[model samples]
Target: MADHAAARTTRSMTVPLVAFVAGAVVAVLLGVLGRVHDPTLSGTTDLGFRTVIEMKVVLATVIGALVVLQLLSALWLYGHLGRRPPSWLGTAHRVSGGLALLLTVFVGYSCLWALGLEVGTLPHGEPVPLRAVVHGVLGCAVFGAVVVKIVAVRARRAPGWFLPVAGGLLFTLLLVVVLTSAAWYVAARGWPGPAGY
Candidate 1:
């Protein structure tokens, strides 16, 4: 019994560690590509509004924070799935969930700003309609899932599988939103340019 429990714990930790490493590697590659290609991409800047560099910095920071929080959430959830949840696991789960929610909200707001859809004018700027809407909706969905998780936690009735389910769903939604927005941006204004700019 002791050996089995140890094996389960190890397996749980391994899964999240693998996921975190994979996500980090992909994000690094994307950042490198963006840096290499952003300068050469025409119309990367939103004229008469925020500078491109500022926007890039803001987006990069938000995205990086979100990714890190997601990894942390995954790790917490993995621990929750172990044979015995740690004493502080519930608190850790709540913290990670809150952070994830905040990150999703920031991503939605930033996406709107980047697409020039906010309630302000950047001269000659037009919103990327479908892409912006999709991104915003997906972000909201993730936020909603987080809200549900919070409510469950508060009620002290959260199911054992709830955390993992919520995490997986949010991750999937984020991936779809990013990928689709990228495709739309590429189709509209060629590759390696500011996506949804």
Candidate 2:
């Protein structure tokens, strides 16, 4: 009977274990893609922005905003906020979370496809900026964080603590991704124009 109980305990962990592995795979794949892919490095405008980089910053800012909503909604749901969250809060969280995920994925792919990693050498170009390099890496990490969070939410046997931890991690990663890219752009370029707002 004890042996059977132990086996059950181990079995219960399988979902989280799989989620962890999936997260690792996501991080590794994005890192590899960022490192190996050839980039366009074009100065073309996107969505009326002055450059592709500018468009990314705009999208990233929106993602950051959405993640803020996610954090607050999660907090309320977890009772970190006042007693009894509204019924609509859960629905709002889902909607915002979905939007945040979609935007994050879009920006990440755009970066990977358009700029690759901000590599040490850029053919005839100068050395890659450290900020750009960090931004690229953080972008890759965001996908990994997202994978873990999604798995925690979807898995039937995930531990009670798993979802909150995953949610917090996703929030932090997304916030940093925004800071490293969009915040830096705003700091240097002094806010994007009509397209950015």
Candidate 3:
């Protein structure tokens, strides 16, 4: 019984540790690549902005912070589950969750905005309707998910399951957002725009 309990504890810790390490590695690699290549954007405007790489850096930082906060909150919640923690732990969990949600929304918006501007919907070049539409839809979905999470947490009807379920969903969404954004970045760089400018 004791060994089983210990194993469960170890397994719980494994998820958070993996999240943290993965976030750190992605952040470092993206940051280094951004510095080395320093790609430019040129289309409707003859101006250059390292927009994609910058977006990656911003997303990485936000996601990294979110992962750390989520891990901390998870650990606290684990303790509370075993034996009720102090009032402050509960408050901390709420605060951390709120921040994570906020950051996730920001990442989503920034990604869509970057995509729109780069693809020429605004004033740059011929617009790629498909990419724009996909980005916009994903951004809205992320926002909607955050709203649902907020409502669930505040209701406090079934916190034990609610929190974990929400966290898992948000984590999955973050991964998708990261992967898609990375894919779009690569595609943008590979294909030349109006001026290649």
Most lDDT-accurate candidate: 2
Candidate 2 C-alpha error for residue 103, in Å: 0.8
Pick the winner on lDDT between candidates 1 and 2: 2
- The prediction achieving the highest TM-score against the true structure is 2
- Residue 159 Cα positional deviation in candidate 1, in Å, after optimal superposition: 2.8
lDDT of 1 by residue, 15-34 (tens): 44444455445434433433
Candidate 1 Cα outliers beyond 4 Å, as residue runs: 1-61, 72-100, 110-133, 180-197
For model 1, state the Cα shift of residue 130 in Å. Answer: 5.0
**lDDT ranking, best first:** 2, 3, 1
Cα distance off (Å), candidate 1, residue 113: 7.6
Measured by TM-score, how close is model 1 to the native structure?
0.42
Error of 3 at 185 (Å): 5.4
Q: How accurate is candidate 2 locally (lDDT)?
A: 0.83
Better of 2 and 3 by TM-score: 2
Q: Model 3 TM-score?
A: 0.46
Deviation from native of the Cα of residue 177 in model 2, angstroms: 0.8
Model 1, residue 108: what's the lDDT? Answer: 48
Could you tell me which residue pairs clash in candidate 1?
Answer: none
Per-residue lDDT of candidate 3, residues 24-86 (tens digit): 454444334333442334321212334445555455456656666676667666774466666
Misplaced by over 4 Å in model 3 are: 1-49, 80-92, 114-138, 158-160, 182-197
